[model samples]
Target chain A: MLQALRDTLPANRWIRLVLLAIVLGVIFTPWLFDGTRALDTAARLSIFVVLAASYDLLLGFTGVVSFAHALFFGIGAYAVAIAFDHFAPGFGVLLVAIVAGLGVSLLVAFIMGLVSLRVKTIFYAMITLAVASAATVLVSQLYHLTGGEDGLTYRIPKVLTPAFKLLDDKVFGVRVNGKLMNFYLVVFSSIVLFLIMVRIVASPFGRVLKALRENDFRAQAIGYNTLAYRTTATLLSAAFATLAGVLMALWLRYTGPESVLSLDIMIDVLLMVVIGGMGTLYGAIIGATVLMLAQSYLQGLMGNAQDVIGGVPILSELMAPDRWLLWLGLLFIASVYFFPQGVVGRFSGPAPKEATT
Target chain B: MTTRVEPIQATGGEPVKQHRAWWHRPDAQAAVLVPALALLALPLTGDFSAWLTLTLAGLAMGMMLFIMTSGFTLVFGLMDVLNFGHGAFISLGAFFGFTVLAGLESWRLVDSLWLNLLAFGLAAVAAMIACGLLSWAFERVLVRRVYGNHLMQILITMGGLIVAEQLIYVFWGGEDWPMLKPAAFQGGLQWGDLVFEKYRLLAVVLGLVLFAALMAVFKWTRLGLLIRAGVENREMVESFGYNVRRLFVLVFMAGSALAAMGGVMWGLYDEVITAHLGQSIMITVFIVAIIGGLGSIEGCFIAALMVGLLSNYVGFLAPKLALVSTIGLLVVVLMWRPQGLVPATQGGQ
Candidate 1:
């Protein structure tokens, strides 16, 4: 059955190879580079992978442009943090937190969708922007509950911290500690979440969603309740985004408005989706890796740029670490102009058909 | 054959009906609504003087917003382009206008009101010209590439905004500048228990003058006719031997200039300016634009007044929930109107 499953995989050999390499690389990252930093980066990549994929559910498959996605992500993070802070930090608490977070996300998604979906594309986008900004401000002002801009830090399950070592001795050239276990948990859940998303995208419901995105009027003409389909897609996407947010909180052991729900983060998600490729799920993975790595490494390079160049006046100013966003913005525009289909689209050649008019 | 015996009395009835319909016109009704709302609030606040002050302040705020948003609404109405980077022009205007004012410090520091006004006007014109030229290039290079695609237009323009913001940082450093009002407009006017800021009053007067000028140009100009015709049918206008594309570019430039003018006023109002002045204000600007309808200047103007008043009232009453109230207002407006308060198109958004 495993051999048959391998045989029936899509003929995209390069993509499969890339995926295999990534999974193996992440598994061995602790042994490969600096242990804690490598693990942390891998963990972050996994969280963003989930984020990018969930975003794709709306932007790529559903073709809905929403600016309030990070609101759900923030809610999930806050939920987990609040739960840990108020209740016991145990597995059961975590379970309840996940459910609660997802429930709230679903409810918010439904109401926002109902209100915003009535408008045309541009207006819908604007309304979401307004809602998102308001929610961000609310989160900050409700300092008692949300920790405001300073954010909230909490204890995870005892099993996930470095104090609780899994073994007294080293294993696989690395210490078997609670941190390692936690990293593994993050990677594992991310893989599972990714698979579930893949399954959903491959389903019949997903196909109908694609149809609606391509031409909603035509889909309506064909007797499909486009609104219902869109609302359901929105709910599902919000649920997954919240899960990603919860995972992020767990991995970081802290969550805050700036870290989890900033408009900057929303724009980063957009950059990831567009740079990767909109409709292709594999693009999400690739985009997340490229952006996260660039952000991490380029920031370091920028800080030390003056020392390396030694008084090249223009280069020194241009390479200031704080100026990363400028470069990212330029990269975003170039990608949209030169690669409307994104990197994945370019690599895969032309699409089977036009996904949007 | 019966048409030959039409009654002259029916002709008299037509004039009365037309006059009555004029009162029902959306703009006319909106004009009444603004004053009526102020009167209604007077009793609630129970301080006629304070209420009057707040209402005037709100109108001043609204007029400034209208100035900023008019160009955007007009450009979108005529061109169907969604320029998310419109806010960048606002920031540019504020910065350059400040530069001009600072350079003319000799005039700004004077006790003479006429000299101060001259300095202010020159600064405004300088900012407008700078933004107008930049907007021309923006449309030619960035906007031209993403025409007809709303999604791409939004993304690219957002990219443009970020880039512009970073460039501002590069040129002007990442520090907030504290702006000072000119010597002539520094003090307030007092009448018994009521006191009003001189600058706020000036802002109100300037905004009204600009509004009147725009109304006049639009009402009695050949260019206005072409623009209205172009918005209703771009292809038809083009077929009529007019260069509709040039008109679009002109409108975009005009919009950018107006945004800059609004920015200058806002900077003066806030008394502080930052590199992200545009980005921070964009949320409220977008809300106003949405509430005013996508492509209607008149609608945008009315919505701006309502939002400004709502924001001030809410801020006074519930400081913590100021933003919440504004967003709540947006949701309610969208739910009730859907097409906004005075949608440009009669049907089919």
Candidate 2:
């Protein structure tokens, strides 16, 4: 099972150890942490790992800076939420929602890819930003169907809900209810998706993507269809992100623009992929975990420190919870200048230098 | 960066003025589209007065959008750098303007138009100065380091934007602050069947004046010629012993200051201010920049106007289409002109 879980291993032994610890940490979270938030964090970590790694396929490998990623995620979560809102909550509904999510994401990605062929690289970012901005506006304007700013809440299958009991007794001081099942469902799917992504990136198709990223002229000269490869990457990444969104929706039993569709989430995915290490799945994994941990604990830690500092107006204001973004931004800039290869890239030996593109 | 256009020599340098149709000029054709759009929307609106009002309002909106995007276009043109953090200046301008105006509330409360204008001008200048200095530091501390690395430039500038936004929150608090309109500028001027908001008229007059000033500077000033030459060939300009880097810093500061001024105008236009004001309008800025042709001030102006007009028209004609009208316009325009209405550098961007 452990062997099966290991897909594409990190090259560095230290990275491998970190990866194992992360996996172990997640697996034993139910035993290690006693609160609901801890379990929620684990679930979020699982989802973000898949999300960030998928983005790595596009930004890190193919060099496409898309701003429409959150739109794809929103599509996935909205599909499931809408499906449950309209139909009876059950396995059948879940299957339809999942299928709907993937289909729409693929279609949107395909259209975006085609449109992208017309413009240069930087223009692609502009188009995507415009599209994403328009989408949010449309969602809010068409509130009757999308539930607008209020968002939508719907029930999942009985088995996935907290009231459902899989076993009569408590397992290791934890309730063996549907919440555990939901967590395992997310974790299981996440691991499988992560492994699949790793496999995809390690494949020949990924090599072509890397080549294109390095030098599109050379890649084209080699007879590779650059457009087709780029579109395929977009599709694959969008599909995986959709799956992550589906899992998140099912776990929370709610979907909202802020939760799944905001530009902030897209920024997080970018930060994770870049700061973790571009062009490496391991980097993405590490980036997601680091971000998740920081987001979860940084503010609380700052608040504690602020209490210690007490009534220093400027210092306390600086340490306030809202100012976390300020510190995060500073850290992000420091990393970009200091670790151009990203954290994983710095720790893992330099990628076989392909003459720096 | 794309290839730069060649200079048209005036003294017997191959008679270049003869074989031309006005329609062939991309800029000429693009400029005509703005008024043409208003004409088209007139019928859809079905009321002459409503059409006139909406058209005027749309043009006013376009002017403001142009002011907002003008600085970004210059920065992109001269430096070939895409500053995603341009929004930080916009937000800063708004906050600074708000603070200044709050301090000058006494001057703005009176019914005297001169006093009100004076107060507004002071607030705008304050915003401009604050933003210009901030931009100088931003270029030095953050943007300069990421030169030539677009990815890092984008990431680093975005980080700068985030920090800037947080600082705004820390200083001004998280809630949206109400932007007060001066007592003298509150009412609309009425004419036979047509009406104009005083603020919108001010925006239009100010926008046109600024646009004309920008054009005149570029055409008449040695500094403008140098800047234009620098945009065309930075290395050549540098070779000619002019410090292009210093010129760039100067332009960056000025551009950011204009953007800050635009932010002040926008706050007055919206009658509100918030930290996320820049972020929310970023999409419009990007669309304007792209549609206008990167680095082309003329193109940015035309595109901004078109977007502003189309948004107002479509928003009134078809409520459902209002949200996505600009995107739809982008597709249609791109289909017509692949590199935008006017490509600043030339040869395939």
Candidate 3:
């Protein structure tokens, strides 16, 4: 158990403590937080943590820049949603969707890696962008199946709904209701998935990935089949993203193109990974929490500012609730330019050596 | 017998003697796709006139796409920079033209060809200036720091694209605005049973003129020669005592202005300007650039036409699959010639 713990914990004590606090806070959200909105936010925070961390594996560790991560996420979401629509709302249907989503994501990621990974980095990025855009169009156009752009709303398993109860008595003054049960399902599973990701990153496979990320040609010179390693990383990242999508759809009981497949969500994911600090899973968790809070609260603040500055002409428009994304964009730019290492990297990495001038 | 198909001097510069062979050269062979697509689409339409109308419209659409993609491809070829934020300029141009034309509605409604032309021309000029200026800052501010790093360039530029797009949303409201056409160019001319929109006709003419002018710039002028040389090898061009960085900015601004012009044309054609117009058109622009072979202007033209014709034909036949058809064209072309229809000979091709 100690060896397993060592494999999953961050090397930095501060980072590890922060990760622990975030995870414990999420696990106990039902007892600590009240209201449906709070629960919903906690669930989404868990899902986005997985999403951003999986993206980090591909982007930070492997150094393969892909724009189709959300496409895979959408596939997982739509697979679950469509399955629920067609079949009875049961655990069996959920299982089938998970399997199908994973299979499809692996297949697509494998083919994409083989085709575009052989090319230069720019070519790969452009092709993934093209594919992602095409996927969005297809999703939007297929209204009949995907419920069009409006998306689909379906009931999940009866046990997962708020009506069902896992226990007759309250546990720690928190009712053992179906909603709480479902939230635990998402949060606990997310913890497991995240720790597995940590273990993988600390494994030998991850060492090869590090070599490739630092210098591709040098890694290849050491007799490592670099292409195979890159493709495996793509597959692993896609699988995790798909699971995150599954958890999200299962929790929300709805799925839509705008929610899962849009470029905006992809942008949000990028912001999380880059701002959180690439290559650090703990940083991803921190990034996701901060972003989710900002999203929940910043837009409301902007709305108030919009009213206060209503008479200020152009400035009023900048303060509108919808304009929060403008700030997000600027933040993304600032992070990329000023702190390429990200928030976690800023503090955790060693200080720059003082010049002996 | 030996074949003389190989480039005699592989000085890493382009424009080899192999440009003459139509049957042998892959890019030249790719050119046949335009006619081939038009002819194949002709019989499917079941009438010559319908096919002609569709083909003409496609050619015009192709021209605008070429104009938009020409700059992006050149930027990629010259700087080795994949500026993902290039779409923001297109959005900027459309909004700029909308603002300009919105102010000149009186001139647009006058019904005189000169006034209408003047109104539209002024809008184009204004839009180009706005887009050009923004592009200059875009290069100097956001793009300058991320040079030489492809991953950072992609991330930073994408950030720029998002910011630029959101800024447009801030300035323009969240709704789609319908663009009003000049009275003189509102309707098409009836040549027998077929009706050709005057605006689309102008698009074709403007596209041709731009192409000719760009070709001349590439072939004749000192600026053109320098740009071509820079695209082939930036370090070599810089080593030759020329200011390649300044030249890059000039070419970047010019290309951005051209994209903005395409946006203005697109706004006129589509007649509805949304904040997402740049994002939507970028899908096609990227595919065209990739299919044309990144960094090859002529290839961009051919691929744009092929994509334009195929999309129009597909839109007519299967409206739902219009975007898919362009993607399909890209897949097919990439499978056939992975480098693009006209792969640039140097600069990481």
Candidate 4:
């Protein structure tokens, strides 16, 4: 049966279609049963998918490993919180929050890009790290503006009408409310962003960016303004990240430093990219989905089986909490060691060998 | 290949004569006298008590800085691979040291000052060995594959750091472990009106000794000669059939050991060991290493001291300013001398 399916879906188009169907099926799985938890998991996974895709613009295509991409995401979330605090609530305010967040990220990215572009690889990572650290400290210290570690809490508008719809009270025997509405909102946003990314990657601009990555010096010699192009890409990446951050804030109905911008968030995004496959756009979505699902299932299983160990209850306690990050780390190492292509890349084979000619 | 300007020809032949000047020589009497006099007079001009405290604290912190950056510079200078996970090794050492000490306390072992010192010494050695072996394995298996690829090295080492940190959180619960300074070394030393912590003074003395020993080894040891040669021309060392891979491993291990030692000292000094220490301070160490030049020991030493002093002084003026001072220093250094304070004679690719 597997062989027949593979044979039937030999073409890339058919494969993509099938993958899309699987994703939609998973997204709409809540309809089948009381999978409220699964719906929440999907929403969280969607946020990560957007984040990982944003990172791919820099990490996969440009070959720059930024350690501070979360700064933009955090800024976006904070922007929405701050905007909601002052402005009247509406879709227009949400749009303004996103723009404001993107604006800040762009300004920061531009300065960082200009300064660190001269230093590639490790040096670039160091510079970006410094910026992120500085930003974190600055935010934490600015007690008045950032709520000083207490974080800001804002009342999200109950109606997200135009962009989303709250189905019937018991639509298909499932309660449709904030969580479900937020679920659709995130899924819709993720699909839209994914499509835009597909278009961007397929464009002539992406080809030039790929060339720049393969051999930057050669690209420059061939008359490409490497720095300008790279800077543009960085800005675009930061803008998308901020947008995802805004969505995250809306989904969670709260924004805090821990939730939005932290080293852990950066690590999660990096894991997603690596596990999914570097360079491939769809890898982001696949990586985020797989990782989140694994985490949720593993945690749930461990949590439920805590009493099964009987005599050594400490074992279960040790098994359940805080082991996820450790497992993720181990997975990252194993992935690098065994499956360097990442999950998606391993299955897909190498990206169509780029034509140097 | 395109025709490239040689600029400065590689120095190949005889060892250059060591220049000795009264004020210029690193070990000169004036070299010590000038800094000593400046430090002594610093209190008169500033808040005397605050300056004294800051100077002492700076000295203590400077030693840790020296240890951290020295490993970073040595590894980068010798291997041309930036071990981004160097901080993880430091964190591992601190956590391991704390665990051993805590275990000893629980077991009702000799709770004497001497025993504590012994425990610390044993922990340091164990951490060094463990970190060295782990670093060697990592370099051999993963780093070796990406010899010339800086981007891959950065990403891989980053992944390594995340793994190590997460493993640490798994093994040791996510609570801070308090460290006890030896009772004999806990009290402050009184000299005239100035009071200083004996432990901090001990740290400074130990750091100086280690620095001297490292310099002596670099000047006289055969392994050191190979390292210097490898730094200049890795290919040439390989061509000579000197087991270049072994040398790389040795350098990386030594670097890891140095960072671990620093971690032990930092834990003792701070009186607490947390997994986040490595991630929190790693950036500052990197800044110091870069500002000092990628692989220069003397440069790292000097840069660490300057940074320690600068950070303390700035923190005194405004605490928040301390956060950005090192980054500001890094930017200035990069803009002025992109290579660093004392760049390698042979330029980097």
Candidate 5:
């Protein structure tokens, strides 16, 4: 069946293998390690895969540099938070939050595109950066609505809460509970979203986006309404990002400015795409998994480093958990310098569709 | 590429002077725009003294912004490389300045005015030299490799920034340090009913001096001429056997030094220094840089002042809406003049 599915798809066998690995990884996560911790990582990883792919839709395919992506993501998180705050926490509330988040994000993306598309690329980036910062400040200041710096904490749907334990029997040394069901909910939705992103990028519209990315001037000359296409891509990307944000808020049971709307999150998305492979949709999954995993484990490494650096005061100081960002930052620069096209590009080379005429 | 020099007339003929409208000259228009806006805002504030104080505060803030952004504008003009990590220099300068001031704590406590000035000058000088040397290394190691690629420049510079910010943590730890002003520079001066913060007055005076000095160098000095010529046509300057590359590196160094000075001044202004100080203030610097034609020094100055004034006024009027108003200003300005208040030689492209 796997071979037949691979044969039906345009992608090579490697994609099939990766997809199989992902499926196996998701199914066996509870058995592979301490159930909650590993499952938590898997869920977070899945959410990031969706988030990163949506970012690639803009940065990779559309060639527009936006610093306001967090705005949409924040809106999604806030939508869920606000909905929970106002309405009873039920499945219906979740659906409403998702729709509201997607609707608002799409509108914002459209308006941002319409205004910024008039200027040059760098100018557009500046406008977005300015807007993002202003939005961030606005979010923090609206204390009554956003809970100010404390952020918003709200209840998840009763069915998804661990207190409603699903199974009495222990499954693979882990208690089968509502939390496990919620984990599967996030994982499965993320998979569906990821597949949708892949399908979108594989479509003809995606090809036009790649063309625009390579050289928009030529794309415009060739009769493509480049601006319209780009705006559409931005809206699509924002919708997916909003979905990811909703899933995150649902999983974490809280949403805040730092988590949802910070510039760092936007940069993290950029880094994921760049490191994974800008034009490759699959790279988003790979980049997110690698970076997220590393981030999770780096804290452990930092704790142990003080012991290893024993006598050297400076080295011990540098090895502190707070200083881990220094290494990550240096790693980011080294990766960009060494792998300009990113890890995926190194293996796949340039996608044939983006070849210059 | 063609040099449009007029041919000498055999008969002592004079070239016709084209009479154009006054506003047609961008320089004339920009010269009037900033002060005109300030004058326009006067009626909004009913109290003259309060209005004057706010305007002066804004001007002082604008001068500090200009000090930081001028170097950024210059680097962009000479080499079309956008250094997103320019804030790293600012942060490093502040940190280094902090160290120098901390060391001179005894000097700061002295009753003598000269001793206080000495402490401040030493710290500023120390910070500048440290930042200049570090920036030289930064340019040689990272910036040189990604010259023409805007995407890579942004990526690498941002990476550089992240690394620098983290390094600050490694050195200084994750704590916000308070930087005290010299005793002489701490208090406000009272003249009858009006009072002006001594540091703000100092900042305004120093900023004007720096602007004047920059203008003088660009207008009269041989090095300045070379730099201007090189910015216009690098190939032409190269053909004339001038090492334009070296000149640009020197300019980058000088720009970094200037940023260091701005950092020291900014630290004094804010009274608190953090690892992320540079990154935080970079938003305003970028706005100023963008609104002041990206590569135009004079335009940068005007834009910085305007932003400073607008921010102060808005903050006073509605603190919650200050950033919103500033963003609104940026959008309006860009919609009206896409290139900025004074368009640079390269423009936004």
Candidate 6:
């Protein structure tokens, strides 16, 4: 039966369809196992998928390596909190949050772009990194606005109840509450954003951006305003990242320094893009899924083995939630050493060779 | 030992005819006066508290900046490959140092300052070797395939950074390690009304010594000459039959070692070592190096000092505006002098 199933799904399209089905099955399997945790993981991974795709717009398409992408993400989350605090609370709050987040991100992008546009490649990367770090410090110091380290939390408003009305109350056709509603909301947003990213990448603007990446000087010589293209790409990328952040804040119902803005998030996005393969929309999703799932599973396994080791309990520490960074670092090193093409790129034929000369 | 070679004249004979002392040259004056003034004034100007605090802080921070940028600048200066993983090396160094120190502590050697120092040294060495081997592996497996390609190098090195950070989390755990000051260097020094931490003062002294030693190596050593030549023209150096690839690795290792040394000092000064330290500070170091000019060691030093002073002073004034200062400086510098504060020598590029 397994051999026949495998034979039936031999084609790439068939395999993709089967994978999609399995993903959906897993997402909805909470009904069978009465475990909503897997659904929560998928929702979190979806946020990452969106974040990674946004990063790819700059890193892959426009050839701009931004170290401050997390700032935009943080800005998005903070925007949501600020918006919810000032305006009426509800699911409708997402609209104001997104606008505020994108607005801040755009302003940041413009300022950073103006500064960094003069320096290309490594220098630009440095400037962006400094800006990101500075933003973090600024946020932490501004006690009135950011609440310092404590961060701001919103009470999950009652308005979200109507959105979950479709659940309607059973086991096979069971009633799902706010958590499940939030999960579905995130999943739907991820799909919409993913589709929009696909549209953007397939557009003429993306081609021009890619051309700029291939050769900025050549593109300039050919009468393209490379700076404008790059700046636009950067702004757009930050906008998407901020949108993801807003979603994250709403889903988690909390916003903190650690929640959205961090070097960890930046590194994670970079890993997702590279591991998924650069210059591909689907690669971001694939990378995010692989990394998040691996981390989740590995942490579980490591957590369980803590008792087996006695002296120098590296395994127990490694299993700790905070230690996920160590695993991520190791994965990054291993990937660079062995699978440079990344998982998706490995099977998607030869990597698209960079033209830097 | 004091043999003097005739100064090479610029093409204009009239300018050469002027009886100006060599000390009048801008570069010569800068080289001699900058350090002299900094050294003399740092301990003299403010009250003991201010002077000692600023000087020690500057020194400690400057050394860390040096480590961060030296390798990055060298790699970019020589091969034009922007190794994003440079910061990862610093992060690794800090963790390595932490691990060694922790191990020593567990072994009931907590009171042994010398042992702690040895652990620090060993950690630095290990970090240098690890970075060198990693670079070699990177070059052999990935970089070699993308030779002369900046974008690919950026992406691949970035991937390397992510993997490294993840591995760090897996092995070391995510919490910040408590950085223990060696017992011998734990106390504060009282010089009149000013009080300075012994550890920070030590860092300052060590950094100056290292700076002098590195400068001496560059000016007086054969290896330095080869490095300079290699930076000038790798093809010509290869034509001269020197092993350029090996030289690249050696230069890279030296740079990584410098960064690792900085990382160790940073751990001591900051009193905390975390996995994020590398990525967090990596960008600022890049900014320093870039603002200092891509390949100039002297420029890196000057830029580092400026960055340290700016960051600290900014943090002091409008604490909320601390982050803005560096980014603001970078913007102004890039706008004013896109090549950096000091342009690379014509032949160097």
Model 2 Cα lDDT, one tens digit per residue, B1-349: 5875757778867666545477767788899998899889888999998887888888888998999898998888888788888999999999999999999999989889999999999999999999999999999999997777666677778888888998999888899999988888887999977888889999999999999999888888999888877777788999999998899999999989988999999999899999999987878998888888888878988999999999989988887787599988888888787777787764111
TM-score of each: 0.93, 0.95, 0.95, 0.87, 0.92, 0.82
Fnat for candidate 1 (0 to 1): 0.69
Residue-level lDDT of model 6, residues B1-349, one tens digit each, is 5877768877856565545586754334434533653556554454545655765676578776876787778777777778777777788777777766666664324567676567666766676666667656655665565557666677667766766776777677667888876666777888787788888777767777877887787778998777777766778989999998787778777787677777777887787998778877887887888877787777777677767766665555456675577777766766666776665553222
Please compute DockQ, using alpha carbons, for every candidate against the native two-chain complex.
0.63, 0.59, 0.53, 0.42, 0.51, 0.41
lDDT of 4 by residue, B217-292 (tens): 8778998778877777788888989997788788888888888888888998998988888988898888888877
Candidate 1 lDDT over residue span A1-357, tens digit each: 344334323346686687678778887788887857778889999888898889889888877888888988888999999999888899999999999999999998999888887666677677788888999999888889888889898999989999998789887778888888989888989888987887777777878888988898899999999999989988988998999999998999999888999988898888888888777776788888878887888788878875687777767767778788788888888877887666776666545344453
Candidate 6 chain A, poorest ten consecutive residues by summed lDDT: A1-10
Candidate 5 structure quality by residue, lDDT tens digits, A112-217: 8888776666666777888888989998999899898889999988888898787898876877777888888899998888777777776778789988888888
**Which regions of candidate 3 are displaced past 4 Å?**
A1-14, A307-310, A351-357, B1-20, B346-349
> On lDDT, who's better, 4 or 6?
4
Q: Taking the tens digit of each residue's C-alpha lDDT, what string does model 3 give over B8-114?
A: 67677766643354566666687787899998997798888878888889999999999999999999988888888788889889999999999999999996999
- Across B30-76, the per-residue lDDT of candidate 1 in tens digits comes to 55666776677677767778787888788888889889988888888
Least accurate 10 contiguous residues by lDDT in model 1 chain B: B11-20
**lDDT, candidate 6, residue B330?**
64
Instruction: Give the least accurate 10-residue stretch of model 6 chain B, judged by summed lDDT.
Output: B25-34
Superposed on all Cα atoms, model 4 deviates from the true structure by an RMSD in Å of 5.8
RMSD to truth, every model? 4.2, 3.8, 3.5, 5.8, 4.2, 6.5
lDDT of 4 by residue, A1-357 (tens): 344334222245643664676478657867853565776677777888888989988888888889889999999889998888777767888888888888899999999988887676677788888888878887788878887687888777767422344665577776666666667888888767766766676677878888888889899999999988899889889988988898888877778788888877888898888877677767787778767876778777666666566457457545654566666777777776566556655666444443111
lDDT of all the models against the reference?
0.83, 0.85, 0.87, 0.76, 0.83, 0.71
Worst 10 residues of 1 chain A by lDDT: A1-10
Cα misplacement distance, residue A141 of candidate 1 (Å) = 1.6
Scoring only the A-chain of each prediction against the true A-chain gives TM-scores of: 0.93, 0.95, 0.93, 0.86, 0.91, 0.85
lDDT of 6 by residue, A1-357 (tens): 344333222234643564475457546645644455676677788888889989988887887778888999999989988777667787577676687678878998898888666566665676777777778777777878887787887755553433545455654665666566667777788767866776777677878887987788888899988888888888889888988898788777778887788776787788888777666656686788877877678666655565455345665665565555556665665654456545554565445454452
Candidate 4 docking DockQ: 0.42
